[model samples]
Target: MSLYNPNRVNPQRPKRIALVIANPATSSSTGWPVGFWWSEVTHPYYVLTEAGYEVTFFSPDGGACVADALSDPNDASGYSRHDLISQGFLHTPELLARIANTTPVQDLVSADYDALLVAGGQAPMFNFANAHALQQQFAAFHAAGKVVAALCHGVALLAFTQTTTGEYLASGKTITGFSNQEEDQADQAAWHYGWLPSGQSIMPWRIETRLQEIGANFVHAGAWQSYAVRDGNLITGQQNFSGEATARLMIEALGR
Candidate 1:
């Protein structure tokens, strides 16, 4: 019998990744300027780019996207003061240049990239949830057996996404997002808006509930656990503190 040669390399080209950012939008609940969380975008941008994967930025509506006010270096919240990853992106001219100019999501089709990264923020809860166009785009990418990663509120999109086969995309996947405890802390600190109605309890509005409703195996590991979970090619991070670890996990999943 002929010897099998496992060392043979395929002629296919190397894969490229695209970072999909939420277009700048205002928070309906809080009336605050909101966009993708800084660390969620920057940390992953740094990770994927350094892995030598060509990364392109895009927004749901296509245009310049802003970072959340709390994520801004000058924000009074000071909640993200210890985020060196975000600070580095703020100061790095090259990375800054990339974000300063982003393409619209409609401009690029699923064929343009090997993977799609959905960055999160309070903005997604308001805008991304109802963005049918964006949900379709992500479903397309996931159906192709390509990687799909989302962090914090970014995973909110998964709650409504359906595969081309018409099944809930997250139906059997394990995922995580911003926890109820974090929401409580943020509301207590900012007081601009409460995610739950008075006496409604945080349980109903938790991302875990939404995912569970869609049949996902969900996990919530307290506030700021630096927890990132990978299921198949679908990756998710708990919240802001999990950004770096999430990025690293994405890098590992992409094998780049």
Candidate 2:
């Protein structure tokens, strides 16, 4: 059915992609350290690297970034213990090395790469949303018609990013991201311990609500389900589980 064999071949001229993350030490409303979601960053990282794409990591403010505590495989909460790939990556120094040397947005030119990916986590609710600089950068990439990708809370920026034409980049595009329902489910599941909700409401506005207001063709598959959508070169994932799926789509769209 599919020509892709995980162990099979390699490409001589791999595609180049850039990854954007939030700066470190920013946390969620519940006080969890957050920058980028683990699966959202790592699964895609692993996929692109294995496919021979040259991937570079960057941050909004140019500094070290941290994953949400729940994303840590070794975390006492074990929120992410179920992620084998993350668990494996947690133990690999070489693989983890990229997170140590992330570049700043000023250091990158969108034209240098074939695609750009925005990662999500709790921190995005605080840092990425309403980020004028980040929106402008994404606008540049989107205007150039290069592949632009965002997952989970990272999708929040779509509501503010405007293309060179002064229109919201996603003004008429079909996309997907963490839905209101999923946020409710995750929040309801963690309420026993007094963990504050991570819903879209945290932002003065919610992602689903804002995206809809901006005329985005936003879709949702269901609670806790992996859902990713590609509208032309724009790739988006709904939540953590959708990260790997989104990465696979990017690879396909890049023809790798």
Highest-scoring model, TM-score = 2
Q: lDDT of candidate 1 vs native?
A: 0.76
Model 2, which residues run further than 4 Å from truth?
A: 1-12, 25-32, 197-204
Q: Which candidate is the best by lDDT?
A: 2
Taken over the whole model, the C-alpha lDDT of each candidate is 0.76, 0.79
| Deviation of model 1 at 216, angstroms | 1.2
Error of 2 at 92 (Å): 1.8
Error of 2 at 139 (Å): 1.6
Residue 21, model 1, lDDT: 79
Please write out the lDDT profile of model 1 over residues 208-252, one tens digit for every residue: 778888899988788778889999888899987777788778777
**Residue 29, candidate 1: C-alpha displacement in angstroms:** 1.9
- Give a tens-digit lDDT track for model 2, residues 90-193: 78896577687678877788767889899988778777764677788788877777788999888977877887778888888999998988776676666656
Report the Cα lDDT for residue 99, model 2: 80
